[model samples]
Structure formats: C-alpha cells, structure tokens
Target: MEPPRRKASFLASMKAVFWSFFGVRKRRDYEDDAVNLNPVQVIVAALLGVAILIGVLLFLVKMAVSQ
Candidate 1:
C-alpha cells in the first residue's frame, strides 16, 4: 500500500516554482518599489482589462461585418 503524501506549504511550493522558472531567489525588493496588489486585485484588474479588450474587438468585428 502507498503511504499518504505530505502536504506542501504554500510559501515553500511557490518559492520552489519561482526559482525553477526564473532561476533566482525570491525577494522583497519590489515590495515597496510600487503599489503592491494582492492576487485577487490583480485577477480582477486582468478580467476588467480583458473585458474592455474584448469589447473593442467586438466593435471592430461589427464594423467589418457592416462594411
């Protein structure tokens, strides 16, 4: 029988993936360099940005269809 797997901590998992992808250690150097936003805030902003982008695209599409 296989043993139960150990759950990984959020920070540890994130750090491991960060280093593997970027080839460097994570730091707080950018923490105060600018306005810092949380994941939810970023996601919401991205969704809003995409919505605006899609609206513009659909407008262009409709214009082309009408022409």
Candidate 2:
C-alpha cells in the first residue's frame, strides 16, 4: 500500500509561480509542481504577481515622467 500524498504549501506554490513568471522553470520542477500544487493557489498567485508587476511598472513610469 502507498502512503497518501501531501498538498503543496502556499509558500511553495508562490515560489513555483514566481519561477514561472520568469520563464525559467526546469522540466523536473514543472512535473513536481504539477503533482503538488493546487490549481486555485497557482491562479491566485499568478494574478497577484501580475498585479504587483503592473503596479511597479506604473510607479516607475510616473516617477520618470514627473522628474
């Protein structure tokens, strides 16, 4: 008999999302994440990351234009 598998932690999912945003994930890591990560967690993390990126870009642009 096999033991039950554990779900991925929020931190782990966030790390996976971060690596994915940079487009530099290894195939082995991808496979591991696929098995461990929750789809909902991935989606939420991705959306938050994108929003943060956009906010940072807007802040930089505003600062550059104001100067």
Give the whole-model CA lDDT for all candidates, comma-separated.
Answer: 0.51, 0.89
State the local distance difference test value for candidate 1.
0.51
Q: What is candidate 2's lDDT per residue for 1-67, written digit by digit as tens?
A: 8754649988888899899888999999999998888888888888988999999999999999999
- Per-candidate clash tally: 0, 0
Give the clash count for model 1. Answer: 0
After superposing candidate 2, which stretches have Cα over 4 Å from the reference?
A: 1-6
- TM-score to true structure, per model: 0.46, 0.86
Candidate 2 residue 42 C-alpha distance from true site, Å: 0.3
Model number with the top lDDT: 2
Query: What would you estimate as the lDDT of candidate 2?
Result: 0.89
lDDT of 1 by residue, 1-67 (tens): 9754434344444444444345564366333212333444444555665686689999999999999
Question: How high is the lDDT of residue 2 in model 1?
Answer: 72
